[model samples]
Target: MLPEVNATRYVTPLREGGSLPGIVEADNHGTYVVKFRGAGQGPKALVAEVISGELARRLDLPVPELAVTHLDPIVARAEPDEEVQELIRASAGANLGMDYLPGALGYDPVAHPVEADLASRTLAFDAFVENVDRSWRNPNLLIWHGDLWLIDHGATLYFHHNWPRAGNVAQRAYKWDDHVLRPYATNLATAGPALAAELTPGLLEEVIALVPDEWLAEFDFPSAEQARAAYLGHLRTRAAAWPAWLPGAAA
Candidate 1:
């Protein structure tokens, strides 16, 4: 399970995205960008962040450490902004926290060219998860200490929004023409197979296990276990049929 920490303070709100994530200080003395469960996307977005971000880390990709943050109602009272205070009040529970990158800059493809292999693997991973947020308009890629890092995976695994149809969309093809990394991911043919090999059922189970039970409780699944099984089933099916979804694999 990811380290669980309680929010000690709400530093400030990050207004860039619609979800209204905020910078918070935790009891561990570490600062994090917190994605609230009260956001419009709900707990499912947090689920996608954990699953997709952890999977990226397992694939040797650069992703920040994730933690489960506990928010107390008291934190909301300290916020002066009415809208932000309301958001904090509603999110008085488990939220997703990403390790804050102090000096990171947004990735610019032209200014900082990525190597073909790394780019290919990133593309393949995004495709596998059906992430649609990594477009040129919102790259969602960061550059810290001269290395690339992936962040903001809340938009992934869209199938979960309608669990009943998730299995049917498991084999859906990824449209990569708009992917920010597509221009540099020329080696997808080789990268796809190599990365897919590492995503074993065991590894996936381990990653899915990191999500907290409370986040899974609100779902309509018979139990948290069933919801987890559904995630595993959807991802496993996608992995097995990579040719249908992997960019350049059909060539």
Candidate 2:
């Protein structure tokens, strides 16, 4: 389970994303980018951040620390913006909090070149996860302290949005041409196999268990355990079908 903390202060809103995640100070003395349960995307987005973000971290990828933040909503009283106050008041329970990375710059493929090795691995990872948000227009990556960090995984795991049709898209192909790091993913063929090998069923189950039951309760499955099984099944299927969906695998 992710460490839980009480939100001490609502700093400001990050208007870049549709969900309106905010910079919040927590009782743990941590500054986090808190994805609220009241956001338009709702708690499911927070679940994605946990499952996908934590999965990325276990894959030897750089992702900020993630936690379960308990919001009181009363903290919204200080906010002058009605929209923000409404959002805060709506999310009076558990939210997802990602450790804030200060001084990080948004990734620009042309300006900050990534090595072929890392690019291939990143592309392969994204492909296996079926992430459709890492396009050049909105890379969803950051460069901090001369290192690449992945963020904003709320867009991954789209299958959960419609449970009944998940099987139909589990093995869906990923297009890499528009991928922000496509040019540098020269070793994707090998990267695909190597990374997929890391996703053992045990590892997948472990990662899925990290999601709080409160978030998992939203799924239509008979129980949260079944929901976890669904995610595990989808990912295991996708991981093994890398030959079909992993971009550049044929090359």
Candidate that would win on lDDT: 1
For model 2, what is the error of residue 165's alpha carbon versus the real structure, in angstroms, after optimal superposition?
1.0
Assess every candidate by TM-score: 0.98, 0.97
Writing each residue's lDDT as its tens digit, candidate 2 over 106-153 gives: 999989999888888888888877788999999999999999999999
Let me know the TM-score candidate 2 reaches against the reference structure: 0.97
What does candidate 1's lDDT look like per residue over 89-179, in tens digits?
8999899999999999999989889999999999999998999999999999999999999999999999999887877889999998899
Q: Worst ten-residue run, lDDT, model 2?
A: 242-251
lDDT of each: 0.91, 0.89
Question: After aligning candidate 2 to the native by TM-score, how far in Å is the CA of 101 from where it should be?
Answer: 0.8
Q: What lDDT is obtained when candidate 1 is compared to the true structure?
A: 0.91
